[model samples]
Target: MADPPDLAVVSQPADLTNAWLTAVLGAAVHGFSYERIGTGQVSDCYRIAVRYAPGSAGPASVILKVASADPTSRQTGAAMGLYDSEVRFYRELVPHLGSGPAPGCYHAAIDAGSGAFDLVLEDAAPAVAGDEIRGATVEQARRAVTELGRLHTLTAGRPSLIEAGWLERGSLLNAELLTQLYTLFLARYREYLSGPQRSVCDSLVTAFDHYLALMSAEQRGLVHGDYRLDNMLFGARESARSLTVVDWQGVMVGPALTDLAYFLGGALPADLRRAHYDELLLTYHAALGPEPARTPEQIREAVRRQSFMGVIMSIAASVVVERTDRGDELFLTILSRHCDHILDTGALPLLITGG
Candidate 1:
C-alpha cells in the first residue's frame, strides 16, 4: 500500500470545521475569495468564486474540491495523484467525448511527491440539485448511454495512456483492493452476522480475488471506476440534458461496459432498468458503427462481464450499509432483506466463479 498524501496543511476534522475562516479566507489568497460550501464524503468543498483585476473579466465562477486526504477513507490514504488523476482524466479523456455528461476540469495542483492538493471545478450544482426530489429519467439514461458510447469508441486501445509526469490514482485496480475489502468486511461483520447468511457473505467476499484474477482485461480506456447514478448531476426532470457526471477519484483503465452495467443496473430497480437496458447497450454498440459488437449474445456477455464487478461492489456497499446509523430498524431491515434476496436468488451470480 502506497502512503497517502500528507495533508498536514490542514490536519484534523476540527481544523476542517473552521477551514473557511482559517484557510480560504486567509490573507494568502489574493484577487479571489472563497467560502466553506459544505463537506462531501471525506473532502470539504468550497464555493471558490473568483474576482478579476482592475479591468479583466477573468474566468467565470468555479467550484473547488479540497480533495480528501483523510487517511481513514476507504482508499486508505490519499495521494496527490488522486487530484492529478482527475485533472488528467478531464484533460485526456473528456475531449474525446466532446459535449457529454462529464464535468469540465479547471485549474488544480497537488504537491509533487506529496499528494496534497486542491481542485478547481466547473459548477454542476444546477444539475445535481434535481436529485433532491427525483432520480434519473429515461432520457437522462439514454443520453448517458450516448456519452458512454463516445467514450468507449474514442479511447478503444489506450491503457495507462495518461500524460507523462502526471500520476494516475486508483490505477491499481488489481486483485489486492478487493481482497482487502473482503477482509475488512469479514472483520466488521463477524460479531454482527452469522449462520448460513454469514456463510454466503463470506463466500462472496472470498470470491472477490478470484473474480479479479479470472476477469479478462480489455483495451482499458476512461473507466468511471465507480459508476452509479449518485455520481451524476442532473437538472430538473423536465430538462436533464445538461447532466454532468462528478466524482473522479476512482477513474481508471478497464472495460468501458463495466461502467455501463454498473450505472444502469446497480442502482436502479430491475423493471425500470430492464426497460432501457437493451437500448442503452445498443447505443454503446452504435459507436463502433453499424457493424460492431451488436449481437444479442455479445450484449448479454458484456452485461454479464460487467455485472460480476457490480456484485463485488455491492458487497462493498453492504459492508458500509450494515454499520451505518445503527438502530434504524427500518434501514437495517431493508439492508437485511436486500442481502437475503440477492444471496438466495444468486441474483448477482457473478460471484459463483467461471465468470
Candidate 2:
C-alpha cells in the first residue's frame, strides 16, 4: 500500500520512531526501542521492543533484518541476489509452508535495484542459536533433520517450487564459478587444511561438473543452502518454536539431501555422525510424506554424493564473511568435520568415479 520504510533510517536507533514503526507494522505504534543483535555478516539485525497504543494490536517486539552496511559484504549480497531471495521466500513461500521450524515473517521488502532489503519477523527469543563449533547432541541432531524433512516435504515435487528461478541454483552452482571459488578458497585456507584435506578439495574441483551431472533432477526440492546448527535457533523455553531456521540467503532448488548431507557433515563430530547418522537419516526419511517416495539406500547415496557441499560452503563462507576469532574457529571446525565425513563415507571416490 504505502511506501516501505527507509532501509538506512530504520537500522539507526536514533532515527527510529513511532511513525516509521507504524508504517512497517501497519498499526498505531506509540513507542519503540531497539538494540542490535547477532553477528550477521551480510545483514544488520536488530531486536525492537515496541509499546503499542491502547487500541492497537501487534507483537511487543520484532526482529528486523536489513542489508549489511559493510561495503564488501553488501556488494557481495547484492551480486548474489541473496536479499531478493529471502524477501521473496517470505512473501511467496512462507504462506504455503504452514507451521514448521521457521519464524513468522510479518513484513518483507526489498529494492531490486539497490539490493537493499528488510524483513520484520517474529522474535523467537529464549531460543538459543545452535553452536556449530560445539556441534549438536543426538537429540538436537534428530530434531534438526526432522524439521528439515518437514520443510522439504511441503515443496518436494511441487511444480511451482521446482520452476521458481530465484529459488534454483543460479550462477552459484556453475562449474567455472565453483572452480574459481575453490581455487580462492584453497589459496586462502591452505594453511588450515591438511595434505589429505587439500587433495580432497582438489578432487572436488576436478570433479565438480561430473558431480552436478550425477544429481537426479526428480529429487530436487527446497534446499536450505546453508543449513547448519549456527543458522538454527533451538528453543530454550516451552513457548518458543523448537528450531526456527534463519539465513535463507543461500536457498536453492536442488537435491534435498544436499542440505541434510551438508548439515550432517558439519554439525556433528565424525564419530557421533558415524554412530547415529543412519538413524537420523531414517528420522528424516520417515518424516517425508509418500508422494516423493525415497528409499533409505537411495537417500544414503544422495547424502554421499552431496557430501562435498559442506566443503564448498566452508570455502565460500570462510572467505566472504567478516573474519572473527569465533568465525575462523568455526570455519576450521567445519572444514575438518566435513573432510572427515568425506573420507568416512568414501565421498571423494564417488565424486571422482560418479558412482
Q: Please, what are the lDDT tens digits per residue for candidate 2 over residues 1-355?
A: 2336463334334556788778777789998888988877788888999999999988889988888888888888878878888888887777777777778887787766667677888888878778898899998899898898877777764567556777765437677877777777767677888898888888877877787777754367777788898888888768468888988877777776888999889999888999998899899888786654788898888888888888877777777766778877888899899999999888888776666
What TM-score would candidate 2 get against the native?
Answer: 0.91
> Candidate 1, after superposition: displacement of residue 118 in Å?
1.7
What lDDT would candidate 2 get against the real structure? 0.80
lDDT of 1 by residue, 272-345 (tens): 55566677667667756555544655755665555545545544544433243431322233234335434433
Runs in model 1 with CA error above 4 Å? Answer: 1-39, 69-71, 74-81, 91-97, 129-135, 157-180, 183-201, 217-219, 235-241, 287-296, 314-355
User: Candidate 2: where is the Cα deviation over 4 Å?
Assistant: 1-15, 171-173, 216-218, 290-292
- Local distance difference test, each candidate: 0.52, 0.80
Cα TM-score per model: 0.68, 0.91
Counted clashes in each candidate structure = 3, 0
Which whole-number lDDT from 0 to 100 does residue 316 have in model 2? 74
| Top-lDDT structure, candidate number | 2
